[model samples]
Target: MVPTMVLVADDSQDTDRKEALRDLADAVAERGEAPVVRAFGSGSEVRRAVHSVEGPMVVVPAFVAGGDFASAQLFAGLDLEGRFDACPTAPLGAVPSMVADLAGRLSASGWTDGDGVVLAADGSTGQDERQAVTDVARMLSRRLGSPVQVGYLNSWAPSVGDAVERLQRNGRERVAVAAWRLVEDRDYDRLHEMGAASVTAPLWPSEIVVDSLLAQHRAAKARLAA
Candidate 1:
């Protein structure tokens, strides 16, 4: 087992978002049966946290819609190379388990057959990350036995409002949004305002999220062992 684990996230300037991430991290650590250190933001905090743990420590990127590539870029900016024994794992968005979670959330939010579904995420400028979001949306669509449109909170087209409007135009009376963000940010708030009949809570502090983290941790350990 890695002696220590760190749940890392890109710094959200909002305190509420930061607290949400911290709470999610704690939940993941508890459910994953490991003590996890919550590290947000860039610079000294990340550096110190990385240095505090030695020898192939597990690092979970608390980000959605971006995988290892995004993590690599963020860590590189933090100068995380050779600082400690760190094994970076895939971001939460890359996990297939999230599809199940989304399904459950949508269903719980009063989603029904024939209702339009939209997977909403904070849009990314990076093509790979945007594609990752689309991939997840497709996976969810498959599970729901319905097609799901992709919408962005920012930096992209086809906003959630646009999706709802499109679905409404097509005669779908009920529309629901499955949130892809871990915290309630501007995007999260915007989803509610977009006039979706229902919007899921942030995709964190849930059993599915914990399972995904464990899956990512196990995969990273296997890769290291191999």
Candidate 2:
């Protein structure tokens, strides 16, 4: 077994962006996942600078469907670089606690019975990823006690706008959008423009992600040690 590595950030991505993830990764290496790291400030921003890295070793994926592609690309890059022992944390979607996190955001957004739901995802090319999104939607639906519709921001049919509009056309007003990505991004801004009554925030800056990252990292690392 290889040594397990926690993914707080995808160093494989742009040089910037994930100072917190990388910092948490480093903290996980030395201390633990959540020990008042020097990096985390206000639980919202990173106080320190993120040093540059050569390549991606582990990706703390934002969401499963989109993380799949980024992780694959990073894995391939590792192969090309001759670093084969790299490991990454499972996608946030794989973390059961995330379901609660999703539900929390929905509730905060005032989602209730008779209001339409659109589980908006970043979209992916893999069928498995699509299934993963659907599975999450199903979970959310059960939690909400109502039907949930899936809408892709890119890649597949039934766009977010279309889904929202479809619900509106059906006379179900007050549509809420649950963005399943890791962090809030520009892509989600348009949801409000589309007249979503509420758009749930991403998964980061929450205890669920922090706790999930720690658990998944320990499990993977334990496997390697075994």
Candidate 3:
């Protein structure tokens, strides 16, 4: 087996963010498969770490969806000028398992068909990124047998507050906001101000998430071997 390094590139300077990624790294190691390193801070920092590795590597963004920072932009800043051994899978949110996690979170919170849901994600400037969040919302909609709206914490239209108001206008008084983030940030805090009856936690520290990360790593390794 090739010595693979699991890289987590995150932009947040918060201590909790670093700790959470470290916890995730611990979880990855617990799988008894590959060695893990928890590098946090910036894309460049992660890039420098990746550049030191001499074998197959999988850089999995610790993000739920592909926001501008988590997608190509993050990797673009890396010093991988000629490195082809490192591979990146899609953002964790795009995987189908996350939809199940979101559904389960909402259902566990007493959400019903009569209730409304707003898929809350951090703001991103790219329309493609916004669509990714929307796609996750639609998947949740299908799972719960109801409609789910998309909302952002920073960039784009249809803020969580706006979604909540719209749902209330549509006669759905009970509204919940499903967190489409990996860790809590200022954006996660804004969920309460949106007037949601309930807000779910970010997708992390779950068996489903660990499974998703492992799956992405395997796929990327396969791609590299091919």
Candidate 4:
């Protein structure tokens, strides 16, 4: 069994995700218990990262929607024996406190009392993944004392435009979109064009997001001890 610990952040090939992964890796590298950082985008990158890591890995699913893609494409094929499998850590989203964090993002984006909110996410193909997004919307709705809409940026229905237009039709003077991504992507600017008055910042570099990732890493370490 290998003795070293490695941290992997899984996500798409988007530029912001790559940058955020590198930044997270650099931060992780400075700590005393720091594991090696290996990040992957496509299958080729995943294979390369796997071949280079000669140790147990804890995959931190950076995707807010879910980790199925990362689990299947990136760290699923690791051949660790007498050590932790390339077990993926918990998802970044779907936690109880995340609604508050997302609310904070909306407020930070200048969301007002009557402004409609659409919790925008990178759409997921899996039922559980989409349900996770819906769960977040419900919590945010309760927190803000207003109904929150769930919208997908890709791979699902109720697109951002649809949600925003529905709010407008409902007579909401303004609507804000709360982003559920690790970092702002190309779609962010277009969100404004979709009839949103404002858009929240991505989850990257936030204490909530970083803490979630590290918490997963620590949990993985605990599992190894067990």
TM-score of each: 0.85, 0.73, 0.89, 0.83
Judging by lDDT against the true structure, name the best candidate. 1
Model 4, runs deviating above 4 Å: 1-13, 31-33, 66-84
Give the alpha carbon lDDT tens digit for every residue of 125-196 in model 4: 566677777887888888899989887766577888899999999999899998876655565556777878
lDDT of each: 0.73, 0.60, 0.73, 0.67
What TM-score would candidate 2 get against the native? 0.73
Q: RMSDs, each prediction?
A: 2.9, 6.4, 2.2, 3.3
| Tens-place lDDT digits, model 2, residues 1-226 | 2233323323333433355345444544554432222222221222121111223233344345543344323322322134344344445563567877888899898998899999888666566677788888889888889888888776577888899999999998789998877654455555677678999877666766667766665665555445
Model 3 weakest lDDT span, ten residues long = 66-75
Runs with alpha carbons beyond 4 Å of true place in candidate 1: 1-3, 42-44, 66-76
Q: Residue-wise lDDT of candidate 1 within 50-98, one digit each (tens)?
A: 6677566777777775322333356546555774456776565646777
- C-alpha-based local distance difference test score of model 4: 0.67
CA lDDT, candidate 4, residue 126: 63
CA error at residue 64 for candidate 3, angstroms:
1.5
- After TM-score superposition, the amount by which residue 122's alpha carbon in candidate 2 deviates from its true location, in angstroms, is 0.4
Angstrom error at residue 56, model 3: 1.9
Q: What order do candidates take by lDDT, descending?
A: 1, 3, 4, 2
